[model samples]
Target: MRKSKSFSARTLDANALKSFAHPLRLRIYELLDERGPATATGLAALLGENTGATSYHLRELARHGMIEVAAGMGRGKEKYWRVVPGGFTYGDAPPDAEAASALEVLLDDLVRQRGSELARWREGASRAPAEWVEASGFGRRSLRLTVEETAELRDQVLEVLERYRTVADGRQAEAAEEGRDPSTGHVVIHFDVLPLGAVPEDEAAGQEADPAGQEAGPA
Candidate 1:
């Protein structure tokens, strides 16, 4: 049976990235997923786009099963949109070259956004001194858990992050809620976990003894 939760949310895992591949669909999914429920007009307003355009994109998303109509948000006449409850996953869906391309497109948009900001900073616009500036990423070698444990850990972190997904410090309050590019600026959390190749002989040299009390090495 599926896990139950409020927010009428769908718990997604490996299928999320695939469903989120389309550009407009991804944006619409994010909007509906994050902001609760919205209408086509509301989505367009939040995205600075035409309502018709938003509606067309939403139809496409629905057709592809990336989103679904949320309950209790609409009356008889008005229409509403929302992400399917727990309606996403990460890697469960079938492999799609289109989805991979869509991911590349999303990554490019992120890079372009960062580049735009860097350009602004380089223009000598001494905005309030950088509050935080650091980039750190490293590969690690460690394996002490099964696949189930790894999934649990990832889910736990995601749940915690969702709690603060809309947190703000007063500046551009709406930006935080609506997920727009902040007029001042905003922070990003780029967390990733990927599998690496098997451990090498050099690194294995540092491990402590195994259960048999012998130096840790390939059994």
Candidate 2:
């Protein structure tokens, strides 16, 4: 397990990012980061992939230092892997066409995964504990701001998250040392600020206009 800290992050080189851009590899990394240590067989079972295939990818991840052997788990032919403690940040998309393509693939996979997780959560909401059912939520709001203000807001949010992270890490460390489990609940936060430029009146009208051949019909 990773040691407790305020927050840690690293930027991946283009090659490292490219290596991590694979769909299965991304999923594997997510699993390790979220669920802690697990053997290749364990991950394979969860992902519905063959153990051999998973093992191969795990080795690839290890080569890139995205994951490492869980030393607490006894060493043998079987190996348990855990994510390196930190987050990944990319200042800008890679300039290389191939790297850019890989980035697109990774982003698409992430969007799909987020949708899947939400669907799974919704389906199981009724069965979830009362506290979780009541606590979990979703919301959206549109804000008008200059680019400078937007950047400042993002930095503020990151600062707040890092503060809370320090507390969480301390608690986790204490629990592990005491030979007890930490919180079982996991929180997923999705944050984004998309700027949709002004649309022309003609374009707006065209979008609202029905197709010439289509007749209006309603229930």
| Regions of model 1 farther than 4 Å from truth | 1-19, 92-96, 103-191, 195-219
* Candidate that would win on TM-score: 2
lDDT tens string, model 2, 1-219?
111133365666678778988878988998986776789999999999999999999999888878888655746677878776445554457898888887776766667767877888889999998988898998777888888887677667777766766665564445434643544566666666555545677866776795774543311
lDDT of 2 at 38: 88
Candidate 1 per-residue lDDT over residues 1-219, each given as its tens digit: 121242223433333445555567766766665565689988998899898999898877676566667544567856776554333333322356666555555555545544554565556445445543323222344667766776676667566655554343222234335555534433444444443334675656544434465533211
User: Quick one: how many clashes does candidate 1 have?
Assistant: 17
Look at candidate 1 and tell me the lDDT of residue 129. 50
Cα lDDT listed for each candidate = 0.54, 0.72
